[model samples]
Target: MTGITISKGATVIMHFSIKLKDGTVADSTKVNNKPAQFQVGDGNLTESFENCLLGLSKGDERTFELGPDEAFGQANPDNIHHLDRTKFTAETPAEEGSIVVFTQPNGAEIPGIVREVVGDSVTVDFNHPLAGQTVTFEVEILNVEGNE
Candidate 1:
């Protein structure tokens, strides 16, 4: 701890756990025995998430509760798409709650969850799984570097 704090330009290493409102952990670096490493201002983290870690130093532990807007964000109705049932194959059945991957015109892959399978239609939601839900973050900073 040489007066280095978490801020823009700093690379931080930490263990983190993401928990749902009901206290169920959705993900955790500790589960894999690997701490996360990322730059302070990197686009990997949302502005609100980064703000919660500002000014912290090595060995700092904190927990934060984020609303939907500050977390995964509210679900967008436009992200829901209805496709023809014929588009799906038996191997990847269009069953509700199943995750499916779709390719964009630019050749990028995107994942969506099946919401419903009606007569000739399959509805999918492309929004993040956590969208529209509040979450809790438990973080323990292990190291911070590059912030002079």
Candidate 2:
């Protein structure tokens, strides 16, 4: 490990890729030639995911796999809601397998995928797209800085 290792409160700049079980790339920071910057122990990342960065330093490359429980988590049935077809606008039709954004009472927008559309009812799943799937994380650390 290098002197400035990744730990709680450390800032990290890195490129990462998330792959599914079939080796299909789900997401990658390299897509737009932009790396991600974040501080360790931040709520933006799961505790298990952050733990994978512990002791890593600049110029390090690492890969790890996380199960659903440790990653996006299992899909919750309660998150699936059925709404009337009238609730959808023409611009955002309830098409199966399409993702749609809905505004909550608090004004926060959330994305849900249309699972089915039957007659006057539309079923939408609000779970994270990758929920319940195991994923592999590959990270290349470009820089690491200790907390000030």
Candidate 3:
């Protein structure tokens, strides 16, 4: 295992920070001094994102930036949906930033975060909150191996 030796099914622990296009911190495991662990190619991280760590081993740290297309891609206008406030109940508070779960016709439940509330209409955006934004990833490779 010479350079960047990680492989499929490898378990890795990493400290990471994700910054938005505005340079606002979106998420960081390092803030709390805790690291995240996950198996490679398990669909938790995107292929492009995981590819960045392919051969990195323990104690390897790097800061990389990926463009909007490679990151979350441009935001989609179709993801915006308007729903009546009557759809919400006391048990489920309807407010901006509240995640509301709506079931599809096929019985699969999907969640949308409330973006705005006006009169009787509540605007919910189904797109990833980070969608369309260029992002910077600061990562520290804690461990790497080919063993699943």
Q: TM-score for every candidate vs. truth?
A: 0.94, 0.97, 0.83
Better of 2 and 3 by lDDT: 2
Show model 3 residue runs off by greater than 4 Å.
1-4, 103-109
| lDDT (Cα) of model 3 | 0.86
Q: Write the residue-wise lDDT of candidate 3 on 1-148 in tens digits.
A: 3544667788889999999768899999988989999999898998888989887898888989988777777789899999999998886667999988889999998888899999999998888778888899999987765682
Kindly report which residue pairs in candidate 3 clash with one another: 4-55, 4-56
Q: Which 10 successive residues of model 3 have the least lDDT summed?
A: 1-10
Q: Which residue window of length 10 is worst by lDDT in model 2?
A: 1-10
Which candidate, 1 or 2, has the higher TM-score?
A: 2
lDDT of 1 by residue, 42-116 (tens): 798889999999999998999999999999999999999999998888877899999998889999999999999
RMSD of each: 1.3, 0.9, 2.5
Worst 10 residues of 1 by lDDT: 1-10
lDDT of each: 0.93, 0.95, 0.86
lDDT of 1: 0.93
Ranking by lDDT: 2, 1, 3
Give the lDDT of residue 138 in candidate 1: 96
